[model samples]
Structure formats: structure tokens, C-alpha cells
Target: MIPLSRNSAVFGLNIDPIGHHNGAWRHPLTQVSRAYDISYSLELSRMADAAGLDMVFIADGLSVNRYAPDSVVLGFEPLTLLSAVAVNTRNVGLVCTVSSTFTEPYNLARMMSSLDRISHGRAAWNVVTTANPNAALNFGPETLPDHDSRYERAAEFLDVATALWTGWQADAVVADKDRGMYFDPDRVAVTGHHGQFFTVEGPLNAPRSPQGKPVIVQAGASATGRDFAARYADIVYMVSQDLEDAKAYYQDIKRRARDHGRAESDILVIMSVRVLVEQHDNAAQERAAELAELVSAEATLKRVSSFIGVDLTRYALDDVLPPLPEADDIQGYRTQLALVRRLVQSGQVRTLRELATRLNGGQGVLSFTGDGRSVCDNLQLWFEEKAADGFMILPQQTQRDAENFVKFSLPVIRSKPFGRQRPEGATFRSRLFG
Candidate 1:
């Protein structure tokens, strides 16, 4: 079982091909061409593994935004890429995004189950409801479900998938050579799930996984989403701009989890943070500014439009953002939209360009730009305050940034009083909880 260690924060890296910054592919540090090759992903995951990080996450999108095509294209299917990464990196956990909305439960259960076994229990599934409305077109449904319906469907989807995973008992696979028996049939169960969104027949054809069940990861920020996460997720990914908000989210999720009769440790709240590391603070800030300058405003607006189901192109760059639709009127990612909306309405952001810059360049996630030691000190404050169980490093640029984070932050992380010796050859579950 994965044990809890309050001292150490579970670090993770979102190893995107071109980094999380929209302009990463254009930066001097990133080689956009190499990211198209599988080797690039392998290299990043290997670095994460060496750093003793808990997990490496891969985000996936079902459809391409034709309106915002200038940004770097992440071509690899998350599962396919993580599968390759699984065989290559021995210790690090692999987390991949998969929508519960459009995918079949049985198919998803089988694939994730197999991946967990292949990775020897280092697999985590990031459950999503396919927030991008454009994705509906690609899935052969021009119209998308409303926000509440989507979460409802997702709840049922998780139920079916989780049931299928446990359909076969741990001892079901007993290859008795003398009797020519493959397994004990009595130990296998058929899920026989029939629900609002889907019906899944049980006993996954695969054997029970090493971890019994792959870790469950959830990232939903709305009230319904938070409650859903509290009920099922082992990990909750969040986006926050400051410590207070982070702490609030951390406490809220933990409280919601307790309400569901689950321990606070059962849910690991991981904040999505962009870390820009350099030899000096000034240099890091300059690199971040340069990367921001490279992002296309036209593309950024369209990307935002696709996300919030609002056409932002109608407004000029320098003009104050127009009044946004009510949160209920939105069918896309409501939590982030609400965050950004409050920023504009509260006079924190004066222009559309300013908010677009933050969304496109900063990825609507929080940022920490400084030299290695200084950056670690900032993270130390958050960790000690219980703002999060861990921080997922969303690099704004490629190779060098990740290299710097490891080269610089590793020593400090090791030196911290909370540091624990990594258990060798243990399942990712053990690494997290033990």
C-alpha cells in the first residue's frame, strides 16, 4: 500500500512534447522537431524517474483546434506514449488523461488494467469529462452534454470501470500445470453494470493487477466536480495562483473527502505549477518574458474561445474583456473560466491581451520563476503550509528547464529535513504512501 509521509511533497512533471507554455516550441531551449519523436518523451520520463518524483503526467486532447493551429501539436496518444514510457522507466508512476465521457468503460478498464500490470502497478488514470467542446465534433456528436450531465455520466463511468477492475479476485490466476487449469473460474466475477451512461459486462479478460487497482487521478474544480473527485479520486490535480487559494482548495477537498468517509491522505492534492529555473532570478524572468512574447495572440484568443465556448476574437487585444456569460451558460472548463473571469471583473486584469497572455503563456496555472535555491524556498513555504500534498512541475520551456530543475532542485530537495530515502524497486503505490 502507498504510505503517507507528511514531510515530503510528491513531485511530478507534466512532460509535454513542447512544454506547457504555448510558445515553448518557438523558444531557443526547445527543439520542436525532436518532440515529435518518442525518444523525447522517454528522455523526460527517465529524468523524472532519476529525481525520485512520484509521477509523470501526460495530458491528452481528443480534437485539434483548427482555429488555433499555430501552437505545438502534441501528437502521441497518452496511453500509447505512456505505454512506451512504462517499459523504459522502471520506478516512476505514469499518469495519463482519459475522458470518461466518450470512451467505453470496458475498453478503458482493460487498457488501464493491462498498463498497470505492464508497469507493475505504476499506472494512474486522470479522469476527465472532455472539457473541450470542439472534441464533441470529433467523437461524432456535434453537440456536447451540459456540464452537470457530463459529470453525472462521469460518475457512472467510474463506477462501471472500477467494478470491472475487481471482477477477478487476486487468486483467480493459478496456473496449475498438473491439472492443466489456467485459473479458478469460481473466483472470477462479471461486473454486469447497467447505468445511465453505459453498461459494462464484467471480469476483465486480464488478470488482477499488481497494485490490485491502478491509482485514480481526478481534476475537476467545480462544486460537482469536487464532490465527484472526493468520492473516487486518489489524486486531485488543481490550478491555483497563490498560497491562500491553494490552501483553501486543499482543505476543501480534504473536507469533502472526509464527508465521503475517506481519509484526507486518501486524496493527494497536486497543484499544477509552472517552474522556470535558471542560474539567476533575472535570467529566469527574462526567459519567461521572451517565451510569453512568442505566443500568437490570435491563436491564444481562439484557444480560449474553444475552451470557454465564447468567441473572444470579437474583442480587440487592448480593450477590456467583455462581460462573460454566466458560469451556468458555459459548457466547457468552468472552474478555470471562473478564475479568469473573477480576475477581469475584479480589475486585476485590464485588457483582453493581458488575460490572454496569462492563459496562453502561463497556461492559466501558477508560476514560480527564480534561481534553484530561491525557487525551492518558495515551494517549501507552500509545502509546510499544507497548501498541497505535492506540486506537479509544468515546465514553460523544454530540456534545459527540466535539466535545471533536477540539477538545482534535487540537491535542495534532498537536503530538506522532510526528505526520505526512496524505496528501491517498490510499486509506485509504495513510493507514494510508504
Candidate 2:
């Protein structure tokens, strides 16, 4: 058992306004800020930081106008937004997603390194593979790469990026004006990388960052993703619907981390959970219903079709699965199909629409409900069971929901000891591991 600390850590939120569920963006209180609205992002970032939370993370995509054009889309690139947030927040870590599949390791290295430096050690990178086929088209590809191939590229991409990050000695920059030297060239080594995915030559033009490299966070729940997280991730963001499954995944990843020669403490497993919080339980439940009602059945079906790579419109609401010999394109569809079968076997859901509702937000990602104390109690249960080291929170509808997390949940969390506190001015690594 991971011993409870003198104080439990406050959870951080990941705002996936559009990516989370169909109705999230349409919530009555949601601000329709342009996806890239820096001021809007900064407000949230500062709020989280002020709450004494660990970080604010943004999930990204290269493609525009996915799922439904009428709905909100990824407005600005995540790294760029992080840079804007860097100017506003003092303490909260800023993590941004970038795909190893589409970006060159060298550019990724430089960008993340610079952001870390600019933020004075508060930047992190969430490495991902671009899984959507539409992303491939947007990036000028005819088809998406196979699942295994994407991981293979990511492995090499990480290797090259790390080499580039380590290429510069921390003492390389010595601004000795009297001696007329800006930096010692001798201490910098060019990272000449030759790989299947990318070729790069570098000493990262940027100097060593505060944390050496931005904390490498990875999020994928697939087998290849698990392997990647075990090997490279400093923080692993996971999506699991149940505590039992969450624990199994957590233990498996930590074990894998040990096999890869990393201490379990070096890896922080963060489950992505959404909470629907209100002043009262009934109010909360009503809010959830309002949010659920905003969901467009057509949009949900389109998203499901996109996710499963089948025309869900053709099937009746209660139709059973057809054979999948023809739907060879969608990587996760196979898993979804299997899950549907199991749900049928278990009698949990009876229709495709019902399955879509269940799977929408809380399906893949863990979700919670009720007042603040209850939510914190549930979180403590997960932490006590070693189901997760912590969580990456996603609020269901409004920014007020996120604000409620900070206002109500955080105080209780910070008051109950669950993990060690870092010394003043501690690095993230120190804060996490010390």
C-alpha cells in the first residue's frame, strides 16, 4: 500500500471542452472562447495555481474541425497557449500534448526546451500518437499509419529527443562579459540522430532547461502506449472506468517501470476523472441531466462512427454487432466492439445509443459525482487502494465546476496527509519523489 501522506495532494484539471463529451461545450455556463483564447486559458491556469494544485495540462491536435464543424475545435496549438499561460501563472506546471507521429524530434526538443526555460521549469510534454485518420489527411497523408508502426516511431522519436536534451551540459552557458565569452562551445555536443522515423542533427540550440528536460508525460491506454509509458513517461495519464481495472493497470505500469530500470517513485500514474459538483447532491444531479440533454444524438453517432470507423447511422439503436472483417481501419474500434459484446453479455446496456452515452466521457475516462467531501472521499479510496498515484481532473460542464473543485475539494485534499510535501523551491521531481 502507498502510505497516506500527512496531507493529500490536490488534483489538477485537464480542460477538454470539446474532446471530452458531446454536451460539454454546449453547457449553459460554458464560455465559447476561441479554442486558442490565451486570456481565457490563463484565467483557468491561474485559478488552478492559486488553488495550490500541481499543474494545468492541455490536450492537442494538429487537425482542424474534427467530429462536427458546428461544435468547438482545438483553436490554438497547445505549446503556443502554454507560452501565453507561462506569463500569467507562477507555480502550476503547464503540460501540452504533441504527437510523436507527426512532429520531428528535433523541433519538439527545441520547443519543449524553450517552453521549460521560458516558464522557468513549469513546462511538460504529453507525448501522443495521432490516432485519428482525419489527422493524417490534414497532415497530407493518404491514410493513418498502423498502430504498431506509430509506436515504433514514437520510441525512436523519444530516444532522439532525449539525446538532444542531454546534449547540452548545464554549465555550457557562462555569460562571462569580462572574459568575452557567451557560452563554452566545447561543452555542447551535436545530437546526430539517424532513425527510421526522423533524421536530425543537433545540440539542442537551447541550453539545458531547469528540470533538465520537460517532464515527459504520456497518455495512451493501448498495449503499445503502456510500453511507451513504462519506458519514457515521468507522468502517465490514464483512462480507466473502474477502480479494479485502474488498480490492475497501475500495478502493471509500475511493474513495467521497474523492469525498465526506473524506480516506481519516478513514475506518477494520473487517472483522468471528471467530477460533476454542486452545492447540493440534487443540484449536481440536475446539472448532469442538463448536460446530458444537450448532447446531440446525431453528433454523438458521428463521433462514434468516427471512433469505430463504421456508419453507426445504418444500425438500429438495439442492433447487435456485425462481423468486423470490413472495418479494418479503426484501431480502437476492435476494443469498443469487444466492450459492446461484454456489455451485452453482462446486461449493462441494451442499445447502441445507450452504449454511446455511457462511453462518451466517463466510458474511457473515470468519472465522479456529488458534493466536494464525497468526491474527495472517493479519491482517497482510489489513492488508498493504489488505484492511482493521483488524478488529472476534467470538469463536466462549466468553469464553475472547475472552480468548485478548487474551492471545495482542494482544501480537504491538502488538509489530509497522503503524500510528502516538497521543500520550498523544490523542483517538480523533488516535489514528486521527495
Candidate 3:
């Protein structure tokens, strides 16, 4: 097994204005009007930087559905948004999702490399083979490629992207005004890549950024997904409903990394967790209950149906969740389908109503609700036990809850007893894997 570092745990802030909970926009504390405002995201990113968090992650989807009107349907494009945030924050890493299926490898390489330079080496790319079927119509295809085929394309895309990022050597630039020689052509080379998904001819136009390359991140949980991550991803985002499963996944992925001829410690597994923090335990509980009450059964069914690519509305709310089609059959999020099945098979969830409620609140993410100290304790347990290298904090209510975490939980987490210290690295990659 790969042993975790005893140093401070890595942390990332998921800057979703609507929050991770389905009912977050309905919460009184959330500023629903500013969900699309760049100022709002800048404030959050600045807060994360002040709190000494390692990164700020922005998730994006190419298509929207009418069934989940309250969901985050409209927002700034991720790369563009991250570019803005990059200018506003100094220390925090800027990670954004850009789909391999929808984007060309050459364009992606240039954008990420530019962001890396703009952020002074604080950039990471979350690689995804978009699962949304509606995305196809926008991209001139009737449907998304099959699951395995999508992964195949993503693998080749990464190969080309990485090659472009590294094609120019560090010593390639040697400005000599006396000789009028700005750079050494011999030090740079072309990728000349001709792969199944893409064909790129030469080196990228941009010079290498401070970090050598933007950190590669992946967040898929299928068999092919796992293999792809093991082979290429530097950081991985995972979804787990409980501790046992989290540990199992952590070990499994680390093992896969070893099998791929990479050190287990080379990849960091950060679990996505929703947190609700209040000054007192009772108030936090009340806050969670209030959010739960706002969950609409009809809306939940529609959202869930779209997620698994099945019409769950056909069944009654209280009906036992029927057997699902194979993961290969679903064009949407297959990992979400697997999570639902695991919950049912373990008897942790009984009916469509329960599953809907769970997904609506955390999207099947593990949730911790408590006062600041208690929340810190829960995180410490997970970090020390090796269930997670760190956590991607998804606040239930964005502004207020995020402030509470930074104010109360962060200091406690950074205290000496916890041994959590700011990473000493000058670049984002060094901070993550130094």
C-alpha cells in the first residue's frame, strides 16, 4: 500500500455559487442572484487563498436540462473563469474542467499552458470524457461516443497535450541581444502525433510555463476510467458515500498506479465531500434539516433520471429502485449509477425517495455536518486513516458556510497538533506532490 505523507493535508475549494446541494440556491444564506457574477467567484477564490488552501476547482458541463432548472445551468466557461480567478489569487492553484471529447488537444494545450503562466505555475486541468448526451447535438454529433471509445480518445488526447507542453526544453530560450538570437531552435521539437482522436503536427506556440506542465487531473470511476487515471492523472477527484468504500477506492487506485509503473504516492486521491458548518451542533443540524426540506421530489426524480440516462419518473417515489442497465449502456454518468447500486445493494438506501433525497443533497457525496471543531475532527480522522489524501470542500451554502469553515475549521486544522502546514513549494505541482 502507498503510505500517505504525514504533512498537512491538501485542500481544494469547489467554487460553485449554486452550491453542491440541489436545494442550495433556495437557502436563505446563498446569494442566488450573483451565481453568474465573476465578482462572486473572485471573492471565494480570494478567501481560499487567504485560508492557505491548495487549489480552487471549477466544474463545467456543456449542456443544460430543463428538468433541473435550479441546478447550475448557466455560468462562465471554466477556462475563461479560471483565467480571471488566476489573476485575482496568488497562492491557490486554479483547476478547471475541459472535456477531451469536445475540445481539440492543441487548443487545450495552449489554453492550459497560458493559464499556467498567468497564474505563475498555479494551474491544473481536470480531464473529462463528458457524459452528457445533450452535448452531442451542440457538437454536430447525434450522440456521445461509446464509453470505452471516449476513454480511448481521452487517452490519446492527453498524450498529445503533454507532448506539446513539454516539447520546448527549459534551455530553449536564451536571449542574447548582442547576437540577436532570442531562442535556440535546436532545443525545441514537434510532437508529430497522429492518433485515433487527434492529429497534431508540431510543437505548441506557447513556451513552457513555470510548472513544466499544468497538473493533470481526472475524475472518472469506471474500469476504463480508473486505468486511464492510473496511467496519466496526477491528481484524482473521487466520489464516495462512506469510509469503507473510500478506503477501498484509495487502495485500489494506488494499486492501479503501481501496476502502471508509477509510484503510489505520485497520485493524490481527493474525495469530494459536502460540509455544513455552524457555531453550534444543533444549529448545523437545523441547517441540514432546512436544506433537506427544500428538496422537491419531482425535481429530484427529473435530475436523477437525467444523471443515469434512464427515465426514473416511470416508477413511483416509494418504489424500490429497479435493477439498472449495465454501465456500458448508459450515456450519462455511469459512476453515479454504480454509486446508486452500491447504496441499494448494501441496504443503505431503500427506495427511489431515499436515493433522490441523498443525491439531491450531496449527489451521493459523503457529507459531514457539525460545529467547526467536530468537522475538523472528522477530517483529521479521514486524513490520518488514509481514506483521503485530502478533501474537495463543497459547501452546502456557499458564502456563509465557506466563511465559517475558513474562520473556525481552518485554524484548528492548521494547528500544530494536526501537523497541517502550508506547502513549501513555489509552484502548484510542487505544492501538491513535493
Write one digit per residue (lDDT tens) for candidate 3, span 1-434. Answer: 12324556789889987787888888887777778889999999999997878899998888877655677665889989999999998889998899999999999999999999999999999999998888988999998898889999999998899899999998888998998988888888889998777889878998788987899999877888988998999898889886787888899899999999999889999988888889899999998889988877767777777777778889998998888877656767987877877888788888888888767565678788889888899988887788888889998888768888888777777773443655546799988777
Name the weakest run of 10 consecutive residues (lDDT summed) in model 2. 419-428
Query: How far is 169's C-alpha from truth in model 2 (Å)?
Result: 0.8
Candidate order by decreasing lDDT: 3, 1, 2
Per-model CA lDDT versus the true structure:
0.82, 0.73, 0.84
Question: Number of the top candidate by TM-score?
Answer: 3
lDDT of 3: 0.84
* lDDT of each residue in 1-434, candidate 1, tens digit only: 22344677878888886777777888876777877889988999999988777789999888776655675677799999999999999899999899988898889989999899889889999999987777899888888888899999988988888888888899998999999999999999888877777877677888888877788899877888899999999999988765677798899999999999998888889888888899888999898889878877867787677666678889899988877886556778887776677677667687888887667565478777889888788888888898988889888786678878888866777677544435644677777775
Question: Estimated TM-score per prediction?
Answer: 0.94, 0.90, 0.95
| Weakest 10 consecutive residues of candidate 1 by summed lDDT | 417-426
Error of 2 at 321 (Å): 4.8
Residue 226 displacement in candidate 3 (angstroms) = 0.4
